[model samples]
Target: MSYVSRNKFESARKHIQEESGNLDVLGPENRSWWRQKSKNKQFNQSNSSMTVETVKQLTKVFCDDEALINKKLPKELILRIFSYLDVVSLCRCAQVSKAWNVLALDGSNWQRIDLFDFQKDVEGPIIENISRRCGGFLRQLSLRGCQSIADGSMKTLAALCPNVEDLNLNGCKKITDSTCQALAKHCVKIQKLNLDSCAAITDLSLKALSDGCPQLTHINISWCGNVTENGVEALARGCPKLKSFISKGCRQITSKAVVCLARFCEGLEVVNLLGCNNLRDEAVQVLAEKCNKLHYLCLSGCSQLTDTSLISLAQQCPYLSTLEVAGCSQFTDAGFQALARSCRYLEKMDLDECVLITDATLIHLAMGCPRIEYLTLSHCELITDEGIRHLSMSPCAAENLTVLELDNCPLITDASLEHLTSCHNLQRVELYDCQLITRVGIRRLRSHLTNIKVHAYFAPVTPPPSAGGSRQRYCRCCIIL
Candidate 1:
């Protein structure tokens, strides 16, 4: 839409011709533009009557857009611009023009892609197309929840994207051990792998990855029921540089697998063993003792674990910031007291259904842990208003406290909410099933902490009166009940 002054029209045309290297298009050889006829006859009569000053108006300049762009901007700069676009936008850009298609489909523009949003649309054909286009330049790819992608498509991806380092195939149910074998053989640079909820993944898959992908640092096999201690042990023995091993709901995990991880993977930082029901106190203790640098640990649903497991973690894993021991009924106030005294940097903990914990556990946490940000004591019925009083006035409650859940703790009353009003930073509080928590108390709390969210339910104060034509119902208030 740019134009040149009539005086400089010839100069502009010459400049564009030289810069774009198409002299025959706009140079002196092209007399067609001057001889062009006006479709309206009145325009010619107006031009005859116009003065020289009027004829000095701007001249419209036209040039080949793709050629001008190719000459103006560097190819690397164009590719760099395309790199910021997501998969869908990049595909749309491919349809714009020929030059744009070449730039959008360049392998260098697609290093990392997450197709989780289009899980249903992403089938084997779509994966094959992406694999061929992004070949070798693809580094991180997540086809998580794309259940239609089977072993064949995955094999093609592995063969094409040999340098892919991080791959997430979580919830891809159609892929089996053959997909793992293909990836292990071709994509040797893979460091992080997530096979969560891929129920077909078995020992053969783990064995294949162990044999070829030695640089693996993080692996999540959560809900992979076919994976057992044998597979875990094989993976642990091969990947000595492992940092995080998340295998939640892999119930076949036993002492042998835990010991193997402790003995080989010293760099283990995050270990999420949720629902690994068979893990005993001794195995967890060994892991805690060896992997002292553990940052996040989830022992939820490990019903066999006792205070011994907590004590071992308290003594060894000082860096433990997140601990989820929900449903571990054997963990008591004594174990938590030990943990509170040692793990002062504790930020988030989920102790749901640990019914044995009493007011003393909160007292110990309030006195010891100053960095506590999130705490869930749901279904821990023994905790009372006094426990909340200690928590609300603690150092953590000053600014660090954001979320607190005391659901189903029947002993917590309005006094608990009154105490929590002092926690100005508290963002969310859950009080479901605490019958003593009245709506008046919640309103008063909101009056102080204007942004706080209190999740609770309260029944009506009284049932509605029966309707009759001869009667009128009235509610009792301050003077009557």
Candidate 2:
């Protein structure tokens, strides 16, 4: 307190030196300017100020315990070292001395903090304390999975940490629209926000964010079922600079929302509408038409999406690299043919359960997208040895293809494996439920690509039920050949 005046500092030094052998901390080089710093304290150190006598009294207890090398360092150097410590360690260091308390709690040392590891221990009181201490110096704060945080905690945080740009409150179940309203009211610098699984937040929260945080580039409201078109439209119009919008499992989101977003946020680069089953071809078409820079798009489980969506993306979004259309069974080889001709940068494609695709799809991709690496065709029952032959012979398969999944493609046989033996870059292949795939075929493929892992499964034929008896059935066989 009060810069630990020379007289008291010396007295404490003598008192401490009798019990322990040193008064060398707070080195002499810092003595001259230390007095003038009494008037130059950072932010308001009202709560942290302590009387010189208080520090002197504590020195007796602390000196006998252990010396802290950090305490011997200059305040500037001490704070620089504290910057790398996590939140818990900082709290403990603050208890060592009044000088150390000031160094440990310096706002600059609390710029970015992730409290997910201490979720159960984090609560409203602790958050408010951090908000007061961190203030404008805090740029990012992640309170994800800290479910016990109270409804008012985030409101307090938004008010105090006004300059925070990245805030993640995912799975903080108790927070509602009020928290977002507070954020909209105060935190204008917010750029990336994740409110995923914050179930109580509805259209009101989105509207609040839209009206205020115009700089937002990334927003995720996944599983927030109550969000719909009205909220998204406002968000799109207000934050035209937005680049990523993830609303997976938001069942209420439909074509109206996607169209509104696509129309306004033309700069969007990544859009995930996964499991939003109400989304249709028109919405995806609009998105592909507007967001030409689109790199990753996931429409998995949007069953209403047909070939029109894929064709639209192929014709417009030439930058497309990753696309997931799992469970959208309407997609056929015609859509993929167009995709291959346009999106040459395509790398990962997931067509799980898109059963209408056959050998033609693989041929189109193999001949066009030389960068294709991960291709999933689970349940694409029409894929046969002919498709594998075309794929294995392609430069993409030889140079870039890493993983290929053909599970439940019953038409694929040992011949398909034989065709794939030449894909030297291949890493793993899945053949579960491919009833005609034999172990010998896998061995042959692995002989060429020695490090490749072939995941295969086989089921024994079910014998006739034993008369008047129930017996344990043989376990299914799963092997990585």
Across residues 1-481, which tens digit of lDDT does each residue of candidate 2 receive?
Answer: 3554444645765775566446544445434434444455531254444566445545634542233444454668778989999988998988876767888899999999999999867878999999999999999999999999877888889888999999998989998999989999999999999999999989999899989999999999999989988899889989999999999899998899999999999999999999999988889888989899999999999988889998999999999999999999999999999999999999999999998998999999999999989999999989888998999999899899999999999999999888888888899999999999998888888888899999999898788777886654654553322
Query: What TM-score should be assigned to candidate 2?
Result: 0.81
Candidate 1 residue 1 Cα shift, in angstroms, is 19
Q: How far is candidate 2 from the true structure (C-alpha RMSD, Å)?
A: 10.7
- CA shift at 184, candidate 2, in angstroms? 0.2
Predicted structure 1: lDDT: 0.87
For all candidates in order, the CA lDDT equals 0.87, 0.87
> lDDT score, residue 380, model 2?
93
Provide the TM-score for each candidate, comma-separated.
0.85, 0.81
Q: Once superposed on the true structure, which residue ranges of model 2 sit more than 4 Å away at CA? A: 1-72, 88-99, 460-481
Instruction: Output the TM-score of candidate 1.
Output: 0.85
